[model samples]
Target: MSIAGLLIRRERLARAWSQEGLCRGICGTSYLSKIEQGKAAASEEVLALLFARLGLSWTDDADGALHAQTEACMEALFGGDAPAFAAAFARLRAQERTLLCSPCAADYLLLREFACEADGERRPLDAEFVSFLDQRQLALQRVLEGRHEEAALLYPAAAIRLWQGAHLYARGRYAAATEALRAAYDAAAAEGYAHIMMNCRVYLGNCCSDSGDPKRMQQHYAVAQRLAEALGDQKILSTIRYNDAATKIECGDFAAAYAYFSALEETDAMSLHKLAVCCEALGRRDEALTALARAEAMLPEGEAHAPERQMLALVRCRLETPDYLHDERYGTLLTDCFALLRRERGAGYARFHLKWMLKWYKANRRYREACALLEDFPAEK
Candidate 1:
């Protein structure tokens, strides 16, 4: 039974129409009663006919309804309900043609983009999309750089600012993203949009980590943690915990980070891979090797987690092959790995591989390579 069914039943009874009267020439009385009770699904034509008889619209506001549906789809994805997510996605695709003129069309597209990215199946941005993003980013930057108080007044919705911040963060514009995210957070807080506020805080915390502000990162994480707790959303709680562990690594708190990683229930390949890196950093070679093996086992059989495979192989080779940096085989492999990381993922991910490479370079007195790696960050405007 859906909320729509309840609404339809309530409205039908309020009009004092018997099931036989409502269904007279359109459907059987049993069918109408079943539809009212949610035991049978009503086709679009049936709903339209019934609503017309009741002097009401079948879809009150299609745009808002579509947006709500999209949000429901996203919620399923976040909760890891694959079957529900698939059904919702199929429904959205089927309704796309009807929703073409919807005011929330852009929002639906953005949500789809987010869905793809989360699944690690993101498509390359077209030139037009890139151009649109560039313009929005420029506008967000201007807002952040100029008036502090007029940001919310300038944007039509506070949530748009959060989207801008997320875009900036994904593109490695951490400082700008941090500012935009903070502004979004404050506006969401003022408006009592608790979900948006919590999300802003989480992303702001991540951006702070990327921008080298551990204090700000911790502050944002603390607030987001409380929000996640109060909201009682497992997805939000898991995301916050994952980011907290990753931030611990960024802060060089390897032991604490390892503890956090080890405590996780669902040991995904990424977490195991990170835990292996932590073990390697702490000079626990045996533990690192075991973790790497577990990570590899956790990875899907074929055509999935390619980057993790490359990384795991590289990590294993580096561990076993003495003078790995000096070896020509590993040297070429490292170059190929670096190229793949940069091209396939982004600067954020490439940095992880570079971190280990830089450490090895420094250890082996390859200061020139180490320095060059250090300078490989995306150039700021």
Candidate 2:
């Protein structure tokens, strides 16, 4: 440990202090432990008190604690040396802590990010909206730093449930995701946090789709679409529409599924995939390939890559149409499928889907391919 770290520790111990002792009015013992162990950083107010508790001069600018964080936030809102609007908005948020619960916190966060983005106003919107966004920025900081649980502050109701469900889904815990998302939906139904509710519903639909619970997926999309319509949120409505398209495709409503996606201004990945699936269902092999290509193009690069893209790649390789042929292009599709099958990390429908694919190949007189797939599949217990 550095001398400063050692001094802090010695002074704390000399006072017969526990990590919990330092956290009395500020945070939790576990929180303090992480800080003292260098796994976390202490807030300025806590550090000021720590010095005072050690009978030392408390001569420090308290904002000094969050100074770097504020600077980084500004940089995020304004990267260039140009004037930063986010700084002013951030200052307002910091100065008026009461702004935390304001209705426009969302707008403030948007502005703050925009300030970094454009280094100027991006759009002509209302002042109330900006103020609300400022509060949201502060809330995000607290949440990211693990202070949400400490302060008992919550996310925007819709975002809260959406994130909770998303987190559970990432952990392969679908049941928990369903419960969290449903709570969020229910809460929104009463109070109308429409945009957030739509996001939550989007995530809920995704979970249900993977679980093969198409009914829940359809229901979520319906409710989300209704909420989006009420809010006049076209973007989210597009998402819900695309999800509904996927559900339609699953229900074997190929014509309706195609029409649904064709109507959307901005179709999502699942929509593209579903559109492709519709083409396959209609025996339009060329169109199906194009839709699959479109879906692949829509897959975001790097870590944000959607898992469904992998699944779709798998389908392209193994899923056969009498109209389709085995060639180098088909080989690429097969390779993509194998990669997807190898990386099927989630439970429930993943293995089941692969099993069904294998069965489909065999039933179609593709014995060689079925044997090849069986070679890679886990031996049945």
lDDT agreement with native, every candidate: 0.67, 0.56
Cα deviation at 203, candidate 1, in Å, is 1.6
lDDT of 2 by residue, 125-184 (tens): 333222223344544444333343221244454444554565566545677777877776
**Model 2 stretches astray by more than 4 angstroms:** 1-161, 170-172, 186-194, 205-216, 263-270, 292-381
Least accurate stretch of 10 residues (summed lDDT) in model 1?
125-134
Q: Candidate 1 — which residues are off by over 4 angstroms? A: 1-156, 301-304, 363-366, 378-381
User: Global CA lDDT of candidate 2, please?
Assistant: 0.56
Per-candidate TM-score against the hidden true structure: 0.62, 0.48
lDDT of 1: 0.67
Model 2 TM-score (2 dp): 0.48
